[model samples]
Target: MKEKLLTKEDLAEDHKKAVRGNTKTTREDWLAEAQRVLIEEGVDRVKVDRLANKLNVTRGGFYWFFKNRQDLLDILLANWKDSKNDPLTHTLKGKNKTPLDPLVRFIFTTIRERSYSPALDSAMRDWARTSNKTRRAVDLVDNRRISVLAKVYQGLGYEEEEAFIRARIQYFHQVGYYAMGVHESHEQRLHYLPIYFKQLTGFDLPKEALQGFMEE
Candidate 1:
């Protein structure tokens, strides 16, 4: 007997169901899984087959969204780069805010609360040790992030040299904290936060704001 062949419509339906079924394997899902694997098990574990197995889907689903593993890596690098220009930038550059307001908001929203990925941060920095492309991407993000923080300091009326120094201090401290794997308890850190803020910004974080942070 002649075998039945699937038409274009039938194949399209299968594709749709493949995406919407238990797997829901889309481009973002692949990238997110790659990031998770990169963070948890280093970049070596972020393979297409590994992610396909993790997602309970076929490697063909990966190719449906990515040309290859390198393509996924490129997307991951782009995401890390874009993270530098996050909502904190808008808070820093907004109107009607005190100089300290921007500083406090940037610290509370970005660093303390961790608006970006520390695991991916460490992973990318580690990846940078070998790959020139990864190094350049990491450097670009670092420069832009520090530049924004410096501008916030400059807006606070600090001299150019002072602003730059303060920016590096704030930015590098968080990087080092994650890079070195510091183990301070959250409550202890919160208790010391006002002191750190005073030194970092040369002023106190208001009682009300500190209270609000604890509430969060």
Candidate 2:
């Protein structure tokens, strides 16, 4: 016996073993892990090595998905601005039979379903403090969200200035609620939903809306 060569089947079996030892992680998986670290440990700790360890994968996998840590950070910001904010914009843009229908749906999305993440929002805001690029992105998101909200109020028959003011008030109130770390149980928030609705939108929480929240 002078030498031995592996056949295709042998190579395939070796590939399977390699896969078992270190599963291939997708680009989305890396982004999600980076975001989790960004939210939990802050931007400083969202390093490639740190994320690799947390994801239980090699650092090389991250480079396969992202050019560098900065590229991943930029994509994370984009995803948050576009995807994370979709529910809010979608709720407002919906063509409900009544203006209040959109308002009701908006309340449900933000409060009941929690399609937005307060922790992620806070983390981004914290990151903004140190990065001008992040600060601009955050400002753009805030303005866009408020602008859409003002349009919703305008559809409800408010004047331009009043609609803008009301939008700011509602947006500021929710942001501050999270910023201040106000602890309220689900039931407590539900209890105050009607009051908040009235104060924010100048419309009574429809009995049906309240019923829907309770049922949900």
Candidate 3:
């Protein structure tokens, strides 16, 4: 008896089915899964073998999609930024059910909404000591977020420099709160929202309506 070999056409068909199932995946699928894995398990577990285990595939399977682990991590970093602002991100160039308001409530809502992206960002930052690419991507995401908040400050009638300063302070506060152990009902973060925002921007976010404070 002779060993049989698969034709290119047969392999392609198998890959097509794999792509649809997210079991065996394409490069983009690997990127998305890498990002998701990092957010859930951190970088140490984002290795090819582990991802294969997590996805119930084989280690050889990842090489089919990514050049290497570093390449996968890089993709995760890039995707993290896109995930941050795509839904209920604090930054706004367009409309959202909730735009910027009391810094505290808005920050909590964002945490609740975009939980994975921020967790991935934190995981990447912690691992940056070992990876240059991760460090640079983290720096870029932080700066872009600052820029977005600065724009929001300007809309609220602050001078550019003042807006920039307020945005900086607000960012720092939110980072702390995100990592803190503050439990609240849906009403809790919202109820205390004014206190935190007043402390940061010298204005409390009105709970009922945002005051459209920036509306002319």
lDDT of 1 by residue, 184-203 (tens): 88787888889989888888
Question: Once model 3 is optimally superposed onto the true structure by TM-score, how far is the C-alpha of residue 52 displaced, in angstroms?
Answer: 1.0
TM-score of each: 0.85, 0.87, 0.71
Candidate 3: global Cα-lDDT? 0.62
What shift in Å separates residue 87 of candidate 1 from its native position after superposition? 5.0
Backbone clashes in candidate 1 total 0
Could you give candidate 2's per-residue lDDT for residues 80-186 as a string of tens digits?
A: 88834567777878778788888888878778547767788899999999999999988988888899899889999999999999999998997898899899999
- lDDT of residue 33 for candidate 2: 88
Comparison by lDDT, 1 against 2, better one? 2
TM accuracy, model 2: 0.87
lDDT of 3 by residue, 24-109 (tens): 46676667677777767777777775665666554554655656787776666666656354432443444545434434344554
Worst-scoring 10-residue span by lDDT in model 1: 1-10
Give the range where candidate 2 is weakest over 10 consecutive residues by summed lDDT.
11-20
Winner by TM-score between candidate 2 and candidate 1: 2
Which pairs clash inside model 3? none
Whole-model lDDT per candidate: 0.76, 0.81, 0.62
